[model samples]
Target: MVFKCPFTMDCAGSVTSSCLVAEPLRSTGGREMLRVHFTAEDLTRIRIRAHPHPLWEVLLSLHLLQTRRGAAIFGPWRRDVRAALHPSGDILTTLAPPKGYSPDFLTPFVDSPELDDGLEVVLSTSSATLRADMTRLAEQTKLPSWAWRIAGGDAEMMRRLADRIRQYHAQALLPYAHVFKSHIREDWARRAEMAMTHGLEHVLSTLHPSIRWRAPVLEVDYPVDQDLSLDGRGLVLVPSFFCWQTSMTFADPALRPVLVYPVDPVIGWASHASATPDARSLEALLGRTRATVLRVIAEKPYLNTKQLARATGTTPSGASQHAAVLRDAGLVNTQRRNNSVVHSLSKRGAMLLDKPALQDRAGYPDIRLSNPSAG
Candidate 1:
């Protein structure tokens, strides 16, 4: 069964084609009925693969939708996806091609025949299931009815609610940035500096000055081993918390010192102090055994209880307890296949993990006062 919008064109430019494939729930008066079941992961995968850009995967994973409903569903999904894809630390620090590796390096990986086949299968299955669910939902609730069944205002409303929830969360975690200060040191500091510089320069070059000023400019300083000059000009070192790198830029004497800060203490202070409540919520969620279970499922959507338990360092019984929590939270759905139970993060869970932290003031400790040099 399918519910296709007549107004839209298919890939072949045919307007009559059904864009949505819905499974029939029942037949009433010789008419097939159908429910809506689109998963956030499905939409995100589609969005990521739709683009051929080398950074599409990373960027798509980081793009946070602002609708309230989207936030509620997708926030947890984003964290889980992040854990699944790059659990070591940050995605940019882990998956980023080594320095000097161009975007072309990813072409083969992205374009592999096997990869394409897998993607097609996944998308097709998810899309079909979604369509069927949407159809069923439409049939069940005829309110705000359409000529052809489709995801309606309810879906949009859910997304909006999710976004608001995430916004609140982000705001909440912005204060904990100081707690993680000790985590940054030496090489980590240098890498963070570089990442911050790269991101800052990118944003500055692309955005209007007025718009750019609206966003806080995070500055960092790294102790210099020797006097460094680029093109006979003093160099400023900037660290990126996101990219985990230190970047040096040539600038006037006044601006040079302004940009540089001791990387280790600075990053530790900034990250811990600036951590928003939402970030804390996410961290707390991810800290749970259930979140770990969902992460495993997201990584390999078909894991048995033993496999999941091994991956998460838990006993089968513990894993079951965690799974129960996730199931109750609506973060995952389980299926009994033969003798094994297969678990996967729900669409909502997948979507939740994709959003970035929301807008909040990043807290910075009085490093100047703490350090005797400023006096």
Candidate 2:
């Protein structure tokens, strides 16, 4: 049975492909219901609005729309939002993160192990019923995979859909706005006081309802000194997804400072070291010509042979030879753009650049050594 979706069809012509799905009628009993789902692509799409730098408003809205509880609260009104945002299909993609920028940094606050466990407890108990309800809706809707493709071909539809989703989500968010607002307000009010004592950009408190019962969760950006000293107390760096923001713990006095990277930095660090060893080792492995080519591509992705040769002070033929060596080593990748071949890091190459080396330690075998040169 192929029935036209009452909602706008995404570029792929899937009626339910839109960001939110709204069900208008109830079955006999006076129960109202709606369903919302935010994919990783959706998060990136909304990020456009918050672009240039972090936009707290967009971040807060996205946080609510992406979570299970928030989806339940706003599900019924999704159609209204679709109407407002006029969403199309261009927002989704499988593109990996860019150079020097770690996607791990952008992960949400919930990614922490301690917080994840607490959230599981809440979902299994306090929010168990809501989860069940959403699961049912998910099964009933069963949107097709091709729906996401709609955005690729149509720009207008994409803009419209994005706008409508933003508006609708904003409307659905009103009731809970006050709660988050108060939380943000409390954070702002204490910012000055916390800064005076703790240092700049310290975590005022974690807003998760589960952990709020205990002490307000706190975080600090980069420590006051790069030496990783927090007045002799060890710091606990918590894993997180949100970029530029971190969750950390510090006591008043005495111990080694603990630095935590949001994602598993060990794997990333090792991969990076393996891919791009020190200049001398790299020169020895690939010879100076190939080594220079690797360095150029590592510094600037997507450079053509012409640009590569110029950058490396070599002829085009020499650069081409070196590029072949890199490609053979599986260290560099190339894409043909018209007549030009643009070179960039392959997955292996990127991982090598990003992953540092692991340290030998007791219990924490996964921890990577910060300095590869240190014994």
Candidate 3:
């Protein structure tokens, strides 16, 4: 049965056409669920993007920028981006609203992990596809006259759209690209370790707090009720730094199957890196040796005491002592895992690293906008 356009938040919107089944598989406590059917072949074919997908990041980050959600985790980045981004770009805001459907043509699939390549895919969207996506977008969102022109296959309009997207990235995302990469990589390391040790099932089962794996079906908490059957085609798992609260997938089923979920906000090493403390300032607050240990853990998490000692140029006993102090103070979490005590930043630890005082005193430089691989 056809339904009204779905609620939008975190990229979950209406399922138009073949993507939605006649009836939604399940709903609980007024929450919609997206059930992805997988096969053994799909499991083997599952791919974790090595880096963040540049276009997906652009789209998802736009949603966060347009809203006040995740203030604790994303507030600093949002503030920085708002200061840099041009206020005149209504086109981006129109394409990516704070809620509801965003066109699939905005983020086309690209094999190469580069922003330029993905933008090219967006530019080359077939006219029929462009019109169809825009038409569908209009059902949920009021599109402008210029948008309809682009829907009519106006090449100049399409180029303009692509240019604006690129400019938005350079202004909003480029400066903090390192933070995005580092956080996503932390997640990648965790997932990779899980797949190697506990297996892929474990990875899927724990992707997000809202996602669950039940044999062949991966259920996700969504704003709309829908079910996508992958058939023989496997799913691509895209871990997003800006995707907050829940998970999202494409509205169109015919497109390649991919699931985008939020990376854990609490264990964000990149957030700490961006807002690092000044050497002397940290030393004053935490003492020299203890300061060094905190910095080491922020840069490289999940390190054992021996590894931490080697990295910090301290003896194992000294490293243990420092870690114990941090743990006692609720700045770090030390737990025995895989037969060794591993250390990671606690939520309080991450919050302390994110303090405005540290960032201001540190004299953090502008993150150089360099061309890097995307996830």
Candidate whose lDDT is highest: 3
Candidate 2 lDDT, 1-375, residue by residue in tens: 011011222344222222222433442334321111222222222100001111222232243233222232334333333332312212211111111111111122232222122223322332333333224323434423332322132344333333433332233332122233333334334433443455322321322221111111122222111112233221333222221122222211122232222221122322233244543455566675565566556645677988676555567888888888778889888789999998876776655544212211111111111111121
Q: TM-score of the candidate numbered 1?
A: 0.25
Clashes of 2: 38
lDDT of 3: 0.70
Q: After superposition, how far is residue 298 of candidate 1 from its true place, in Å?
A: 2.0
The global Cα lDDT (0 to 1) of model 2 is 0.33
lDDT score at residue 348, model 3, on the 0-100 scale: 82
Clashes of each: 88, 38, 3
User: Which residue window of length 10 is worst by lDDT in model 3?
Assistant: 366-375
Q: For candidate 3, lDDT tens digit of each residue in 126-167?
A: 999999888977876678899998899899998777767755
What lDDT score goes with residue 304 in model 2? 92
| Runs with alpha carbons beyond 4 Å of true place in candidate 1 | 1-279, 285-287, 355-375
- The Cα RMSD of model 1 versus the native structure comes to 24.1
Listing every candidate in turn, what is its Cα RMSD in Å to the true structure after a full C-alpha superposition? 24.1, 21.3, 15.7
